[model samples]
Target: MLKKLLFLFVLAVLCLTFIPQLTKPSSTLVTVFKLTENPAVIVKGAQGSALTVNISFGEKEVEELLGQLTKPYPLLFVDSDWASRFPHLAEEIKKRSVPVALLGVQGQSYETDLNLFAEQLSQFEKIFAARPLWFRTADEEFPSSLLQQLQKAEINALGSTVQWKEGKLPKASKGEIISVSYHSGGRPKISDVKRLMESRTYQSVEDLLFRPTVKTKKIPQ
Candidate 1:
């Protein structure tokens, strides 16, 4: 009888220890930088009740857009190639104290040319006085080689869940990242953006990432 009681107790302890392990969900691998072709997948985080905005700065309209914005400025992904041609715009961005990311080379395959990539990176750093924390390709697709380079430089890849298309801004809900770009034929009207800002709270990329209330999820590579 004593032996049987001891055996049952041991069995109960083993079950208690191992049953949860068998039933619990597997831990997911969350990466700081998510590489995906799907934009929705990239912005999968608990965003509370605000929308995040990413503005691709390449044209004069961006300056007007900047003037219209108030507090909680959107992240401006400036085109390094364009900035090299228009230093005045870069200076304007610096003067405003707006947060910025690097919008990779435009109209050229800088990914394949290391020298060109290096030159652009150097030029951007010279103008901004700091390296960019985030980078996005013109088409939002990154080559593995270029991705590796960005990773080595500790730059995170940014993607948008919503985009302005066909001369209209897509209706986006809270917790979405909307990307507006002049190079992509989406010339955001200052009025339209201002209206959206009035309707909803907007957050920068840094705020979206580091917000204590927001919960981040693991996205598969």
Candidate 2:
């Protein structure tokens, strides 16, 4: 009798714990979508031209990802000094026809110093058998001086986040080469903008290449 009573008490405690979750207010149960301050963007100089995308993954995942895609996507790879650990990543990127860039070469002192951008590019070329045409970062914030330095390095195209101040574009290098911005979400979901994706299905790469800056609306936290 004591064992059965103890079992009943434990069952009641379990029910109390789970019942609250099941009986949550309907308002709290609604699906809410949060709009990020910075939306993903793609920059293509011309309508019919290729757009660039970025990935921060190792060789095996990159290879498997590329194998599954039927269409051509211009991938942007950022190589760092520590990339020596993944010696085969460069070759994997080259075979996939992705563009390579070097990170930690700009303002972020926590990473590499600004001086190593060119050096890393050179190192990447030797290692990957392809040259990177642009200099960029995961967080696309470049001071004016760094912009000039990158331009001087012959990195005509720049990949960065699309930022605006007080309804106006920031006074960065305006007439320079192509600048690209992508969804800040490390793992971007194409389904979030399914309607736009479907409308531009025929031009998937070109459509997806443009930045997905959306209007900011208040959403539940």
> Per-prediction TM-score, please?
0.66, 0.47
Backbone collisions counted per model: 0, 8
The global C-alpha lDDT for each of the candidates, from Candidate 1 onward, is 0.62, 0.43
Clashing pairs in 1: none
User: Model 1 scores what on Cα lDDT?
Assistant: 0.62
What TM-score would candidate 2 get against the native?
0.47
Q: Report the lDDT tens digits of candidate 1 across residue range 78-117.
A: 8776777777777887898877777775323645585665
Task: Output the number of the lDDT-best candidate.
Answer: 1
Q: Give a tens-digit lDDT track for model 2, residues 92-155.
A: 6667665455543324532335565566667766776655544555455454445546555544
RMSD of 1: 11.2
Report model 1's TM-score to 2 decimal places.
Answer: 0.66
lDDT against true structure, model 2? 0.43
The root-mean-square deviation over C-alpha atoms between each candidate and the true structure, in angstroms, is 11.2, 21.7
